[model samples]
Target chain A: MAFFILVIAALLVSVFFNSLGAVSLYRFPDVYTRLHGATKCTTFGTIFIAVAVVLYAVGRLLESGENRFWVLIIHTLVAMMVLLVTNATGAHAIARASHRSGLAPAKAVVDRLEESCSRGGASQ
Target chain B: MFIFFASFLMYLLLVWSGSGIPMIEVVIGLLMATVVTFAYKTWHPEKRLSKRGLDPRRWFGFVAYLFGPFALGLAKANIDVAKRVITGKIRPGIVKVTPALKSDVARTLLADSITLTPGTLTVDIDDAGAFYIHWLYVEDENPSEEQLYGNFAHWARRLAE
Candidate 1:
């Protein structure tokens, strides 16, 4: 019963953060800003979801008192690991694609990079 | 493969705790993981296990660079959004950014960094390595090319350099 409550709490927290992240993406001014909010909030929400799964596995293990607990725990851990790697890597790829395609800061006063790159001088 | 071996060991521990399983089962599992690991190693024989000679000073500087610029951008976007919402003025558009990052990894870092920030969403990319960003607020009739690429490249170089 306690475990079920924990799972529900975790789910609610994850959902709340994910929607907040989406709202941030919709409300913010540029690509970089939206990515920042979305990535962090989603990553946090993912962690909570993983936590909920772990809690459920523990509950099942306690109830069954059997070997299936290990399977559940290991699979959940593996999924979490995959999520951690893929999310950050995907975010990096998107960011690079956005930058090289020609997006700029809204109110940037100075742009040394543009000057240096255009002048055949390597960026320091 | 390591994961499989770990799983087998876990299985052994579990069976030993609950009900007795044949030792042959554990040995077979270990053999499978060993074979898989060796096969994987052969497929990537030259892969380095760890990056050596990492410069700590540069790495720490990069972390600070990302944190500082990202925070500033987020706060600025928050204010911009608040104003835009109150004024009922939003000119959403997609602008292309050509970040002249020399390396693919560096470019990728910049792209994700930009996407992670508020108010900006990465829409598409081209083979020549350009980013298309959707803006929630477009203040300029003709946004400069540097406007999209400069800020991201600035911190990207600082972080990745």
Candidate 2:
């Protein structure tokens, strides 16, 4: 009963975040805002899903005393770690590339990078 | 040596069965681990497998980071971004953050953490190790390091430096 409840909760959390992400992707004005919403929501949603899998594996292991479930838990954990690390790195790369390609923030008030670049050029 | 032993143990774990131990599998796993370890050493000769690399304190700090500030930041960022998305209220801009961490590994870790958390995306690292981050909501034209990263830099320094 507890396992089912936990699984249901996890499913709801993931679904909520994922739908919000998709909605934001459609609603946001620019590339940067869209990226922010899409990347973060999906990543957060995936974390919940990973948690659910880990919990299910643990519950199975405890119920049956099976070593295979233990392996499943460990592997799921490794996959979660990889997902977290790679998602951040990949987002950074995309943001950098977008900025370099001259996609400015839509409603930005401050442009520190521009100021810094001019100052750096003057000093050199 | 430590890398070889660790990889050998990992290989054994990967091949472990609930039934009986297999000597043949153990021998093959050991040989494979040794070969992989040697290849790694050849590719990165400067990276020696030292005791410091396996320090329990560092591992503890890393685990603490994953559970503590990182987890909190993820949740907070998600909520904040969700609010921004719903309300269309964002003041996005690029800002410079110069953390005191000197090591390359620590700096990279800090950059990755900042990019992962709360309305921040690490855009570039200059020659002087200053990070240029694209913030989703920029409150100030020139924000302090504390304003940008809270205690993330401190945690990165502890864990990686």
Candidate 3:
């Protein structure tokens, strides 16, 4: 009963955050802020989903004493790690490319990147 | 050496069944690990992964950070972003943070950590170690490492440096 409750709660959290991620794309002003919303929220949401799946796998492993469920847990973890790394790196790439192509943030109070670009760009 | 052993162990662990493992699987695992190690070395010739990560203490620290501060910050970030998404109150801007990290591994770790947690998206890292971040709520033009990413800089230094 407790295991099912935990799994349900995890799924609920995952759905809420994922829906928020979709909403954020329309809510934010520019690509950067939109990236902030879409990337972080989805990444976090997927993490919860992975957790729930892992929990399910664990329960199966314990109930049946199956070695296959162990593999299921491992595969889930590997998928989660790949998603986490790729999500963050992809966000960075999009943000950098947008900034490089002269797409500035909207309604900004400060842009040190633009400031640095104006001042002959920052060098090592 | 580190890559080879780590990959070998991982491959064996995945291939392991409840019964005794077969010799063929062990041979295949060795071959795969060797190929991966050589490919990694050729791709990043300049980066000789330091022995620092090999220290067991660092691994323990990293695991603790993952479940402790990293997890907490991720929760906070999602809640904060969710609230802002609903209310439509965002003070967005690109600001700079200079975290004086020496190694590339540490810098990348910090950048990824910053991006995943909080209202910060790592836009770019300059030729120097300064990070240009798109903050949802820009409170400071010149924010410190703590302001931008809490103890992530310290954790990066501990785990990767």
Q: What DockQ does every candidate get?
A: 0.11, 0.53, 0.74
List clash counts for every candidate, in order: 38, 0, 0
TM-score for chain B of all predictions: 0.58, 0.84, 0.92
Q: What does the lDDT read for residue B55 in candidate 3?
A: 88
Tens digit per residue, CA lDDT, model 3, A1-124: 5776788899999999999999999988899989989998999999999999999888878789988888889888988988988999999999999898999899999999899988987832
Taking the tens digit of each residue's C-alpha lDDT, what string does model 2 give over A18-109? 88899998998787778888888889998899899988888887789988887777777878887888888888788778876777878877
For residues B130-155, write the lDDT of model 3, one tens digit per residue.
Answer: 88889999888888877888878888
Residue B34 displacement in candidate 1 (angstroms)? 8.4
Model 2 chain B worst lDDT run, 10 consecutive residues: B12-21
**Cα distance off (Å), candidate 1, residue A70:** 2.7
Compute the lDDT for candidate 2: 0.81
| Candidate 1 stretches greater than 4 Å from native | A109-116, A119-124, B1-45, B48-161
* DockQ of candidate 1 compared with the true complex: 0.11
Q: Residue B53 error for model 1, in Å?
A: 13
Give DockQ: model 3.
0.74
Q: Looking only at chain A, give the TM-score of model 2 against the true structure.
A: 0.90
The whole-model C-alpha lDDT of candidate 1 against the native structure comes to: 0.61
Candidate 2 residues B36-137, lDDT tens each?
A: 888998899997444565889898889888898889999988888888888988888888877877877788788778876788888777767778888888
